[model samples]
Target: MIVAEHLTKRFGQKQAVSDVSFTVAPGKVTGFLGPNGAGKSTTMRMIVGLDRPTSGSVSIDGRSYSSLRSPLTEVGVLLDAKAVHTGRSAVNHLRSMAATHGIRRSRVDEVIEITGLTSVARKRAGGFSLGMGQRLGIAAALLGDPHTLILDEPVNGLDPEGVMWVRRFVRHAASEGRAVLLSSHLMSEMALTADHLIILGRGRVLADAPLADIVEQWTTKSVRVRSPRAREIAEAAASDTVSVTSRGNGYLDINGATAAEIGELAAARSLPLHELTPTTGTLEDAYLKLTGDQVEYKTKEVR
Candidate 1:
C-alpha cells in the first residue's frame, strides 16, 4: 500500500501541488487524473523519491521509499518511457536495471516475453518507436515483480493491442493484491480499468472516491426520450425546476425529472412516445462536469 499525507510541492514562485492527501491501497487500481500543470507528475516523482516534497510525507507499505533496503522489490514505477539509455539495446538496458537488485536473467527473459519485446530485444532503444519504447518501459517496471506499481501514461504511444495489454496487465496486477496507482489521459480506458479514482486539478486533490461514486456525485440524473413530439413533450415538461435538451431527430434529454414523470407528462399531453429510457452520464461525462471549472487550458471551440 502507498500512503500520502499532506503532500505538497513548489517550484520557485509556482505552487505545483498543495496539501494533497490520499492512499493507493492494495487489490485496487486507483486512477490519477488531472489537466495539464495539475501536479500529478510532481506527486509521482515524490513517491519514488525522485523529487523532495516541500512538506508532508509519502511512504510505501509502512516505510519511506528511501529507507527500503531493496526498493526495487518493494515498488515498481514507469514514470517516463523515454528515460532509458538511448544507445543501449533493450536487453542490455533491462539487464542493467535487473542487476541493481540481483534479479536473475531468467526473470529478464520472462519480462521481455511478457511485454512482447523479444522482437526488438537486441535493438538499440534509440531506434525503437514510441509504442515500442512504452513496452520497454513496462518491461523494466515489471523486472522486480514488486508488490506495488506506479505508472504514468503507460499507454501513451501504444497501439490498440498494446493498450489492451496494459489494461489486462494492470487489472491482473491488482487482482493479485498489488497496489497500483495509474495516471493517464485516456478517460475511456481509465473508466474500463480503474476501480477507484483520485482526481487532481490546479495542484490540489479535487476528488478521491470509488469510480461509481465519483461519476454519480458529479453527474445529474437524466432521462432520454424518443418521439415525434419531443419538442412538445420537452416544452410541456419544462418548468422552473425541470431542464430539457433537444437532440434533434426526435430525441431529447430531460433532467430534474424522472422517466415516469416525463412518461406521464407525455401521456397527459397526448404526445405519441416511441421510447423513454432513464440514463446516467458516462465517466467521461462526469469527468468533464467535475473538471469543467478546473481546466487549465481551454479551446476556442470543441469542433
Candidate 2:
C-alpha cells in the first residue's frame, strides 16, 4: 500500500501541491485524475522522491521511499516514457535498471517478453514510436517485479490495442495484490479502468472515493423529451418534483422525472410525443461539473 499524508509542495511563490492525503490500496486500480497544471505531476514526483515536498510525507507500505533498502524491488514507477536514453536499446535499458539492485539478466528477458518488446529489444529507443516507448517504460517498471506500480499517462500515445493491453495489465497487476496508482486525464478511460478515483484540482483533492460513488455524487439522471407540444408538456411538468429546461432544439430536458412518470403525464394530457429518451450523465460530465470552477485556464469565444 502507498499512503500520502498531508503532502504539500511549493516552488518559490507558487504552491504546486497542497495538503493532499490519500491511500492507494492493493488489489485495486486507483486513478489519479486532474486537469493540466493541477499538480498531478508534482505530487507523483514527490511520492517517488524526485522532488522534495515543502511539508508532509509520503510512504510506501510503512517507510518513506528514501528509507527503502531495496527501492526498485519495493516500488516500480514509470513517470516519463521519455526518461530513457534515446540511443540505448530496450534490452540495454532494462538490463541497466536490473543491474542496479544485482538483479539478473534473466529477469530483464522475462520483462521484455511480458511487455511484448522482445521482437524489438535491440532497436534504439529514440527511433521507436510513442507507443513502443511507453511499452518499453512499462517493461522497465515490471523488471523488478515490485509490489507497487505508479504509472503516469500509460496510454497517452497508445493505439487502441495497446491501450487495451495497458488496461488489462494494470488490472492484472492489482488482481495479483499489487498496489497500482494510475494517473490520467482521460475520464472515459478512467471510468472503465479504475475501481476508485482521486480527483485533484488546484493542488488539492476534490474527491476521493469509489468511482461509482463519485459519479453518483456529481451527476443526476434526466430525461430528454422532444414533442410538437413541448410548451404544453413543460407547463404540466413544472412542479417542484421536476426541473425543466429548453434544449434549444425544440425539446425539453427534464431532471428528477423518470420515463414512466413522464409517459404517464403525457398520456393523461394526450400530448403527441416524438421522442422520450432517458439520459444519465456520464463520468466525464460528473468530472466536469466537479472541477469546472477549479480549472486553471479557460478559453472564451471572441466577439
Candidate 3:
C-alpha cells in the first residue's frame, strides 16, 4: 500500500502540489488523474523521493521510499520512460539499475522477456521508438519484482495493442495484492483501467472515490426516448421531475427520470412510443464537470 499524507511541493514562488493526500491500496488499480500542469508529476516525484516535498510525507508500506532497505525491490517507479541514456542498450540500462541493489542478472533477462524487449534488448535506446522506450521503462520497473508500481503515462506512446497490454498488466498486478498507482490525463483510458479514481484540479484533491461512486455523484443519469408523438409526450411530462430535450426526428433525451417512468407516462397518455433506453453519463463527462473551471487551457472556435 502507498500512503501520501498532506503532500505538498513548491518551485520558487509557485506551488506545484498543495496539501494533497490519498491512499493507493493493494488489490486495485488507483488512477491518479489531473489536467495539464495539475501537479501530478510533482506529486509522483515526491512519492519516489525524486523531488523532496516542501511539507508532509509519502510512504510505501509505512516507510518513506528513501528509508527503505531495498527501495527498488519494494517500490518500482516509471516516472519518465525517456530518462535513460540514449547511448546505452536496454539490457545495459536494466543491468545498471539492477546493480544498485545487487538484483540478479537473471531477473533483468526475465523482465526483458516479460516486457517483450528481448528482440531489441541490445539496440541503443536512442534509436528506439516511443513505444519501445515505454517497454524498456516498464522492464526496468519490473526488474526487481517490486510489490508497488508507480507508472506515469505508461501508455502515452503505445499502440492499441500496447495499451491493452498495459491495462491487463496493471489489473494482474493489482490482483496479486500489489499497490498500483497509475497516473494519466486520459479519462477514457482511466475509465477502462482504473477501479478507483483520484481526481485532482489546481493542485488539490477534487474527488477520490470508486469509479462508480464518482460517476453517480457528479454525473446525471438519464434516458433516451423516441416516440411518434414526441411533442405530446414532452407536453405531458413537462414537470420539474423530468427534463426533456429534443433530439430531432421525434426523439428526445430525458433526464431526472427513468425509462420505466417515461414508459408509464407514455402508456397513460396513449403516446406511440418507439424507443426508450436508459443512459448513464461517462467518466469524461464527470471529469469535465468537475474540472471545468480548473482547466488551464480552453480553445475558442472560429465562427
Per-candidate TM-scores read 0.94, 0.91, 0.96
Local error of candidate 2 at residue 197 (angstroms): 1.1
Computed on alpha carbons, the lDDT of every model, listed in order, comes to 0.94, 0.92, 0.91
Show the lowest summed lDDT stretch of 10 residues, model 1: 294-303
Model 2: lDDT to the true structure: 0.92
lDDT per residue for candidate 2 within 67-148, as digits (tens), equals 9988888899999999999999999988998888999999999988988898899999999999999999899888889999
- Per residue, candidate 1 scores C-alpha lDDT tens digits across 1-303 of 999999999899989999999999999999999988889999999999999999999999989999999887889899999999999999999999989899998999999999999999999999999999999999998999999999999999999999999999999999999999999999999999999999999999989999999999988889999998778898898999999999999999889999999989888878999999999888898888878898888778866
Global Cα RMSD, each model:
1.7, 2.3, 1.3
lDDT order of candidates, top first: 1, 2, 3
TM-score of 1: 0.94
Candidate 1 vs candidate 2: which has greater TM-score?
Answer: 1
Model number with the top TM-score: 3
After superposition, which runs of candidate 2 have C-alpha atoms over 4 Å from their true positions? 226-232, 245-252, 267-277
